[model samples]
Target: MNDFDALQAVIRRLAAERQAEQRACEAFLNALYHALRTASGPGLPLNNVTFDFTPDPAERLRPPPPGGWHAAWLRLGLCEVLVRVRRDEGAFVGEYGEGGTFHLTGVTEDDLILLARRLLRDVAAAYGGGGLVGRSGMPLN
Candidate 1:
């Protein structure tokens, strides 16, 4: 094949791979959302959770990079938790922190889920009840 043809072939393959990766990431996010909601029970305070798939403008012209970032937020009582995911050298890396005070990094999905569950449980215990009043002055149950 000519050089131009070879480059085109590479682009096609990259596009296909990027599409598949996006789909997989979406599926994983969906599963994680459901799991968090289920674990929350009664009222879902995570309604505002969203996923951003748009690539940065600078990165848009070329094929999608191998590693990128994914993030979501959760509110537990007055505490705000930031959950982040990224592809690091062919591996999935997860991290979570609360108000920038406490952070746990380099965790897997399972570990992150477990930590979230524990955080919820601990917050509930600390509040002496199951519901927590959020920053909006509303109880998140």
Candidate 2:
């Protein structure tokens, strides 16, 4: 193709790719909402469900905010490996994992402290389901 034609072709291709990515992001987010829903007030449910996510335009289509609940889940999920329990619900649901459904119940002051401490080391890994889990035994620092 001529030089001008080649440049035009490249520009067209780039535009097409960007459009595809935008559509994909939208579809994926929509599907995600229909999959992991929150059932209760002011929190995401650990139960399998669906939810609608209205992304913020100012953030350039970034996903919803990572609230405190999500942060808590990262902590508990990491500790879960060492504790040997069921799958971490809060990770997906965005709320405090149900203590009744698992070992850690009764969100007491001490429990919160322990969870925060455990997650501190491995929060970066926690995002994509990868993270370090502290040992089960309390060594007494």
Candidate 3:
């Protein structure tokens, strides 16, 4: 197989091996969500979480780029129901060639669910028709 195909095969294998870990992570996020809901005194689920993608975000928005940064926007919410007040918990990102990984930085389950829901929506929309969206925060130096 070509290098790209071989790399994809390896990635798929690694992903399969990590399935259990991903499930556990999801469970942990769910627990956190329940606790937040309990403390909040009742709630269904927050659909407020959003994914803002741009070829490049404002210099202020990006963390230091590692491993040849790729154009992609990502936001992981774990208790972001509070928006600018609390903060999204499980957010992370990476380049497309690098295999985007959703790093759950262990935020409240509520935030995780909210963030996941939004991401799922974004994924669906991306494949539905529109090619990957691109935007620029500031022109690359």
Best-fitting candidate, scored by TM-score:
1
The worst-scoring run of ten residues by lDDT in candidate 3 lies at 79-88
What TM-score does model 3 achieve against the real structure?
A: 0.30
Ranking by TM-score: 1, 3, 2
Model 3 regions lying over 4 Å from their true place: 40-141
TM-score for each prediction? 0.43, 0.25, 0.30
Best by lDDT: 1
What would the per-residue lDDT of candidate 2 be over residues 1-141, giving only the tens digit for each residue? 899999667666667544544454444334333222321223644343323333332233222222211111111222331111111332222122221112343344454344434433343345444534436543212
Relative to the true structure, candidate 1 reaches a TM of: 0.43
Deviation (Å) of 7 in candidate 1: 7.4
Error of 1 at 20 (Å): 1.5
Per-residue lDDT, model 3, residue 94, is 25
**Poorest lDDT segment (10 consecutive residues) of candidate 1:** 98-107
Residue pairs with clashing backbones, model 2: 33-51, 37-49, 37-50, 125-130
Give the C-alpha miss distance for residue 140 in model 1, angstroms: 27
> After superposition, which runs of candidate 1 have C-alpha atoms over 4 Å from their true positions?
1-9, 41-63, 73-82, 87-91, 98-115, 118-141
User: Global lDDT for candidate 2?
Assistant: 0.34
- How much lDDT does each candidate structure score? 0.51, 0.34, 0.37
